[model samples]
Structures are given as C-alpha cells and as structure tokens.
Target: MTTYHFVGIKGTGMSPLAQILHDMNYNVQGSDIKQHIFTQQALEERNIAISSFDKENIKADQVIIAGNAFPDEHKEIVRAKELGLPIYRYHHFLGEFVKKFTSVAVTGSHGKTSTTGLLAHVLEAANPTSYLIGDGSGKGMENSEYFVFEACEYRRHFLSYEPSYAIMTNVDFDHPDYFKDVNDVFDAFQSMALQVQKGIIACGDDPYLHQMQAKVPMLFYGMNDNNDFQAGNIQVSPEGTTFDVFVRNSFYETFSIPGFGKHNVLNALAVIALCHYEQVEVSIIQQQLKSFKGVKRRFSEKVVGRQVLIDDYAHHPTEIKATIESAKQKYPDKEVVAIFQPHTFTRTQTFLNEFADSLSQADAVYLCDIFGSARENAGDLRIENLQERIQNSHIISEDTIDCLTGHGNSVLLFMGAGDIQKYQKAYESQLAS
Candidate 1:
C-alpha cells in the first residue's frame, strides 16, 4: 500500500480529502505548521499522524497531495520534487478521483458547506456513498457507488471538476481580492457549468444563476412557481421549517427540516431534486434530510446558562444575512447578537457598506478587527469604518469579550471565516468563571 501525504492537512478542503483516503484504508500522514485547527480533531480521532513542517517528512514511497495554499517554493514541495514522486495539487487529485464513481459537485459562493453536508447525509441512505464536505468532513465506503463533494469557485478552482451533476446554490459577488466584480464571478461559474457531464441542479432565485446557459440539462429549484423544482406553502416554527415540493407545478412531497431560513429550504430543495433525479426513494430522502446533524463551524451551537452561542463560517455579507436570518427564525423570542470578524481586509474594504447593512439586521452588533492576508496586506480599510456605519455597535477584543454576557437570553452568533473562534473561546471561558 502506498502512503499518502497531505502537505497542508488541516485545511477545510484538504483535511476532508485526507480523511476520505484514510477511511479507504490507505496509509496517510501529513505535515503542517503545527497550529491547532478545528479540522485536526477529526484527523486526530482517526489517529492520522500530523507533524510540523519538515522536508524530511516526504519519503520515496509516497504520493504527495498538496493544498492549493502551498506553492512550489514550499519546503515539502521542493523535497517531493527531489524524489521524483508523484505530486498532485489537491483539486487535480480530486478531479481524477471523482471520475471513478457517480460524482456530484456542490459549488456556490455561499451555502456550499451546508448543502454538501445535507446532500451527503441524504445520499448515504440511498446508496453506498463517499463524500468530501468543506467543513472538514469525509467518509469513504469500500464499495461506494456515489461520490459527493464540495467544489469552490474561488480562483476558478471548481473548473478542475467534471462532475456528473452539480448543485449551484447561488452566484453572488464575493472574493474581491481575486475577481474584479460579480460579472467576473459569473463567468467563472458559467465556465464550470459547461463542465458538468450529465445535468445541473441550480437555484433559480439567483438572477445570475437562473440565466446560466449550459450544454447539459438544467433543473431550476426555488421558492417560487417560476422554477422547474419549486417549494411552496412554507412555514417556520421553533422546531424547524416545513415546505411542500412542486415539480413542474405538481405536488411531489412535503418535507420538513430542522433548519431555518429560505437558504436552508433552497439547499434542501437542491438535494431533493438531485436525489429525485438519481431515483432515490423519497422516504429515505425525507428521513435523512431531517436527521442531518449539520457540518462543523457552520452554525454549530451550544447553550450556556441563558445564551445560545453559534459558531458559523459566514464571512461574506450574503452569508452573514442568511445566518442572521436563520438565527432569527429559530429563536424569534431571543435577541440576536452578531459578533462579526471581517475575514479579509480586501473583502471588508470591498463590501464595507454591504456588510454593515447586513449586520444591522441583528438586534445588536459587535465588530472585531480584520483578519488580513500578506498578499493584500496593506489596505486603508478598518473595522471601525464598519462600526461607524451601525448605530450602537461595539468594537470588541478577546480581552473584553465578557461584554457579550450582558445580552441575557440572546443568541450569540460568532460569525467569520478567520480566527473569530478565539473570541468565542474567550467568552466561553468568561462564562465558566
């Protein structure tokens, strides 16, 4: 058996691939910077050895899978080249591996992780399924018949895949650091849509997505009658959301999921459409959809005293709005407090007002300093600029996180893609004291 080495095993996408290979009974080990990330917990549970970065970690009898974050100049890459061992970029390796089974690529600017998790759960009930979810979740069956994975559109990375089917959640302007504007982002998804081998299941509500022109057959799903797969008669209560599916304006089934927000409904609808197309039993689809426990760091919740602390990866303005809406839907009686840390300086600078407007939807708001990258290290943007836009918004640090304790019976949304969890951790420690 050949050993598989992941250059950056703790990454959201890389970690899951490592887990999938590990579950398949492959010899797997990886090297990273030694900082503890949430993804490492799953790797640790499997006893996958992870060590600090060293060129010596690479051996003669290994196939190296490097995360896209690492470049040719990375020490491990240099060593892998010296040995003339096969080295595959993470996406390139996934693209090849997916060809072995009936593959479904879930891609979007937002909701990819949540939708991928939902689909994976539903599909596993219908067939022997393997999945790679963005929240660092993966499972492999030795005789798997279906492969479900999340494909990101950033830098056109999703174009690396040629899936039999795709679930396009939406196309919204994001990642200002890379693409020039929303049209640039649209062009990238449009290019990816052309690569689907069989069909595409896309959300029809998105103006950009509904207009997508692809060679493969497309089914549009949404909350309105305008879509090929539509969900209507929706109701939301504390328990969850209930909606009826209409296929070609005909009633198909009524499904209820223990998740709130129109985004969640649309996500479930996308999965339902794909499962329907695949001939999955409707009973199995409904059961697994409701039983999905959710992915890591995407609205992960814990209760302490009178407060509900939710850790979510809602870095974009659109995602922030959806998360806040979900919180409101689930806990209408409680105050929804948003503790937001802007992920990147460029993104904060790009969507400054948009972020402020979305965050203002919450009952109260708290802002954390921007988490920046070295590539676009210098920027005029500041978190105070965002704080200035919202009335009564507080600027907070991990040291002063105790201020959140004042919001009694509140739903605290710890939202961001960066190291925002540190603030949550600090606050949790405050509660313990």
Candidate 2:
C-alpha cells in the first residue's frame, strides 16, 4: 500500500486533502502543532493518526504532501528531502489529482466554499461524486464520476487546476498582499478561465466577471436579463430564499436554498446553471439545495436564549455587507450587531474605508484588532483607525462580553477569517455561565 504523509495537516485545505486521501484507502498519516482546531475533530473521527511535529516522522517510502504555509526549511520537509521521497506542494498535488476525474472548480473572491459545498451535496445526492471543500471537509470515492472542489485565487494557486468545468462567482480586488489591484486579480481569473476544458459558469451581475474572456463556452448566470441563466421573481423569508431560474428567457424551475441574501441566490444560480448543463434533474437539484446545512464558518448560526449568534468567514468588505444583509433578512425585527476582526494588515490597509462603510450596515458594530500575518509587516495601521470611521462603534476587548449584554433580541455576528472565533467562543462561554 502506498503511504502519503502530510506536513501541517491541520490547515483548512490540508485537512480536507488528508481526509480525501484517507477515504480513498491511502495509508495517510501526518503531523502538525498540537493546538485543538475544529478540523482535528474530523481527522479524529476517521481514526487518522495525527502526531506532534517531528522530523523522525518522515519515512522513505511515503509520499510527502507539504502545506503551503510551511517553509522549505521545515524540519519534516528537510528530512523528506534527505530521504529522497517524492514530494508535492498541496496545490500542485491537487492539480494532478483532479485531472483523473471530470472535475468542477469553483473560484472567486467569495462564496467559493458555500457554492462548492452546495454543488458537491447536490451532485453526490444524484450521482457518484467526490468533493474537496475549503472548510476542512473532503470525500473521495473510488468510482466517483465527478469531482467538485473549491479553487482559491489567493497567490494565483488556482491556476494550477485544469478542471473540465469552472464556476467564476465574482471578480473583486482582494489578497492585496499578492495581487496589486482589481485588474491584477482579473488577469489571474482570465488566465484560469482560458484553461477551462469544457465550459465556464460566471456571475453576469459582477462587472468584472462580465468582461472576462474564456476559450471554452461561457454561460452567464445572475439576475440580469442579459445572462444566459438568470434568477427572477426572488423571495426571501426567515426560512430561506426562493427564486425562479430562467435559461434564455424561458422558465426552467423555481429553486429554493436554506440561505439568505442576494449573494446566496446568485450562488445557487451558478450551481443551477452547471447542473442544468450536465442535465441533472430539477427535483434533485432543488432537494439538495434545500437540504445543505451550509459550510462551516460561512454564516453558521447558533441560538442561545433570545440571542442568535452567527459565526462567518466574512473578512472582506463585500462579504461583510452580504453577511449583514443576510442577518437582516433572517431577523428583520432584531438588532444586528457586527463584531468584526480584520484578517490581515494588508487587507485592512487596502480596504479601510470600504470596511467601515460595510460594517456600518449593521445596527451596532464592534471592532477587534487586526489579525496579523507573519508574511506581512504592519505599518501605522490599527483597529482604532477603523473604529474612528464608523460612528458609535466600539473596540472589542475583554470587556466585550459585558458590553454585548446590553443588547437583547439581537443577532451577534462574529465575522472574520482569523481568530475572531476566539472572541465568539469566549462570549458564548460567558453567556452560558
């Protein structure tokens, strides 16, 4: 049996890849820091062996898969090199692995995780399917006819994938540490679009994506009439959102998803377009969309007493606005409080004004210190700089729990891509106590 060893296996993307390989019956074992991450639960449930990082873990016959965050000098990587074991970076290996199946790559600035998860759930229900989601979830079946995966654009890593079908959710200026501007981001997507082998499903509502050039046949999906696949007659309630899907001005089916906001409706439209292209039955698509519990950290909600606490991975300004809008749709009569922790210094500096504008959409706002990245140097930027921009906003700290207690019958949205969960978890414990 071939053994696959992963270094830094607890990472969001790495954990899922490890799960997929393990499910495929590969002898998989790896090491990472002993910190208790939510991803570790999935690994433990599968009885996958996980150990503290040690160079001695490297074996001669095992193929090494290294996480992108690790440097070449990482002890296990160094040992793997010394042993002359075959090695691959996470993205490169995923690129090669995806070529074996009829793969669909979901890529964009946001909504990739939810869209990928929804697509995977829908396809797996109707047909044999294997999927890799960015939320530390993956499944691999030996005889799956399709592979659905989230293709991230950060550092242009998604260009490594050559999927048969690609879904471009939207193009926006993000990952400021890597890409210079929106045009730079667009260039990366355009290059990847040309590489799609079969077809492309893109959001026509996005001005940037509407201008993309692709070699494969392109299908547009959105609320716009110009889109080849459009969603009309939308209805959003506390339960979910319902919309009628139209293909070339003809009514196809009315689909509903257990999600809120126009953004999610657009996300469903993209999936609907792809499934329609593949000739999936309308009933199956509708069933799967309604049944999907949603991806972790993307608008996950928990109710405690009269308060509804939402945890979301919405660090970007656009994502923040959408998350707040979704909260309003779900709790129309309740105050929506946003507790935002900016992800990286570079992103905070790049979209400072935009962040303030978006966070203002909430009824109440709280700011947490920016989550610093080792790769970037923080200059003069601070969370206070953002707090000053929004009127009546408060800085989050140890006193946050006491301050939050003032609001009753409100949705407390803890939003960020980093350790903002710590704040949420801390507050939840206080609430319980």
Best by lDDT: 1
TM-scores, in order shown? 0.99, 0.99
Poorest lDDT segment (10 consecutive residues) of candidate 1: 373-382
Q: What is the lDDT of residue 331 in candidate 1?
A: 92
lDDT of 1 by residue, 1-433 (tens): 7999999999999999999999999999999987889899999999999999999999999999999998899999999999999999999999999999999999999999999999999999889999999988898887999999999998899999999999999998998989999999999999999999999999998999988999999999998779999999999988899999999999999999999998999999999999999999999999998898888898899999889999999999999999999999999899999999998888998898999999999999999999888678845777889999999999999999999989999999999989999999999999899
How many backbone clashes does every candidate have? Answer: 0, 0
Identify the runs in model 1 with alpha carbons over 4 angstroms from their true place: none
RMSD of 1: 0.9
The local distance difference test score of each candidate is: 0.93, 0.92
Candidate 2 local distance difference test against the native = 0.92
Where's the lowest-lDDT run of ten residues in candidate 2? 396-405
Task: Please report the TM-score between candidate 2 and the true structure.
Answer: 0.99
| TM value for model 1 | 0.99
Model 2, C-alpha of 153: deviation from truth (Å): 0.8
After superposition, which runs of candidate 2 have C-alpha atoms over 4 Å from their true positions?
A: none
